[model samples]
Target: MKAIVSVKRVVDYNVRIQVKPDGSGVVTDGVKMSMNPFDEIAMEEAVRLKEKGKITEIIAVTIGGAKNEETLRTALAFGATKAIHIKDEGEVQPLTAARALAAVFKKEGASLLIAGKQAIDDDANQTGQMVAALLDIAQATFAGKVDVDGNKATVVREVDAGLETLEVDLPAVITADLRLNEPRYLKLPDIMKAKRIPIEATTLADLGVTAAAAVKTVKTVPPPSRSKGVMVKTVDDLVAALKAKGLA
Candidate 1:
């Protein structure tokens, strides 16, 4: 069975984002970009499954601008057998992305789909679930662990209440959470090797899919700046400060 893993190119989490002066969006002119951390975890899961001989092929897919191929190449360096780039522009909402992914899933006849629980850039946490809904398949979100046996997969999910176990048939969608596993670092050799791997480029129209944004962003702004910290000399001082602020 083939496992299709989806990765998203996002602003590196470590970088401090700056809002555009026009209040249109975050500045990306020269920001550092990398694979979404959660997506990296998803890729790690797929690599582990392939290593266990549970899956035959790993196809990495992404939807974004032309530079998105860089993210796909990173996935290939992490061990994806091949990559697919959906050439798109502008802000792609979760629903649109899900539609494109569903089309690819059908086209590839893949039995398993893995995706990040959420993209750090938007933090909508909806793409994986939306993909599952679009495909009309079983889904396990925020998966901490996944065990595959033949046509079945047992997933341990991270839920607010606690961990939950779910058993789903093949052709399922699994979203990786932060605790799933640590993603391996890409070596220089792997990066060089990834350059040779083929990354097929296509478009949503080519996949017979249409993706229009269901939501719109009117403006983007930075959060309010934090207040200066005050050093307390003693318990009495701390108590006095809290009491003055009515937070004691």
Candidate 2:
């Protein structure tokens, strides 16, 4: 079996985000960038599968600017055999990203494609499903547990109430949830070796697919500021306030 994991470069979750002065997007000045957390889980799972002798190869792919090569190298340090980068300097729509990934999946003849259930920055949970739809293959999203046997795979997904399991044939897509295995940190040796690994680059046009204009951002507005709450010294005061507001 061969596994392909899709990764992304995103602003560090710990950094404070500020809107650009021009109101175009977030101000990236002096902000640190790191690999998406959920994608880390997906890559870790792929590496585990390879370690178990269940998968023959693990490939990492990403779509973004040149700086995204750092994210791909991080994936390589985690145990991926090769990397593919789809160069797109501007923001890419979810549909376009899915389409581009699907093209690469076809070209590489991947047996399984794993990606995060959603990107933390965009919170767009469409890419994995869209890629599965484009390829006309099975998909299991929000997967908390995954087990592969022979040509069949079983996945346990987290639902609102609890968990649900689904079985699918090979050549499927799986989007990992938070409950998946924890991602491993790269050792110094691996990090040094990853820098020497070659990364293949491709353009959107090279895939014979045009980027689909699926969604557009109109404007970004800051969330409303919260007001201070009044302190109630006693139950009587609470009741009085509620009655004044017609809530009691």
Candidate 3:
């Protein structure tokens, strides 16, 4: 079996984001970039599959500017055998990104594709599903556990009510949830080794997939600021305030 994991570079979660002065998008200048936290979990799961001998190879793929190579290298340090970078300097929406990935999947002939359930920066949960749709394959999203045997795989998914399990044949897609597994850090030796590994770069034209339709961002506004509440001197005061606000 071969596993393909999709990774993404986004603004570091620790950074304080600010809207661009032109209102076009968030200002990313000088902000640190890191692998999407959820994608890290997906990469860890893929590495585990390879380590356990369930898969023969693991490929980490990403689509972004040249800086995305950093995110791919991080995956290599974690245990992926190779990496693929799709160079797209312009903004890419979830649908377009998924289309590009699906094209790559077709060329690579991977048995399974894994990715984060959602990206933190955009919070768009559409990419994995879109890729699966484009490939016309089965997909299990929000996977908490995965077990592979023979040509079949079983996945446990976390749902709002509880948990659900699914059994899929080979050549399926799975999106990982937070509980899937803890991602491991790259050791010094592994980091050095990863630096020597080759990363193949490809363009959208190389895949023969047409560019996705344009998506317009008319405007963006900040979320409403929360109001401060008045301090209550006693339980009665609180109750009175709640009653006055019809929230009692």
Better of 1 and 3 by lDDT: 1
Itemize residue pairs with steric clashes in candidate 3: none
For residue 133, give model 2's deviation from the true position in Å.
0.4
* lDDT of candidate 3 over 126-238, digit per residue (tens): 99999999999999999999998888889999999899999988788999999999998789999989889999999888877666766778866566679997999999999
Task: Please give the range of 10 consecutive residues that has the lowest summed lDDT in model 3.
Answer: 214-223
In order, the Cα lDDT scores of the candidates are 0.94, 0.91, 0.90
Where model 2 places Cα greater than 4 Å from the true spot, the runs are 236-248
Rank order (by lDDT, best first): 1, 2, 3
What is the model-wide C-alpha lDDT for candidate 3?
Answer: 0.90
Model 2, 208-248: lDDT tens digits are 86888778887765556798899999999999999999999
Whichever of 1 and 2 has more TM-score, that candidate is 1
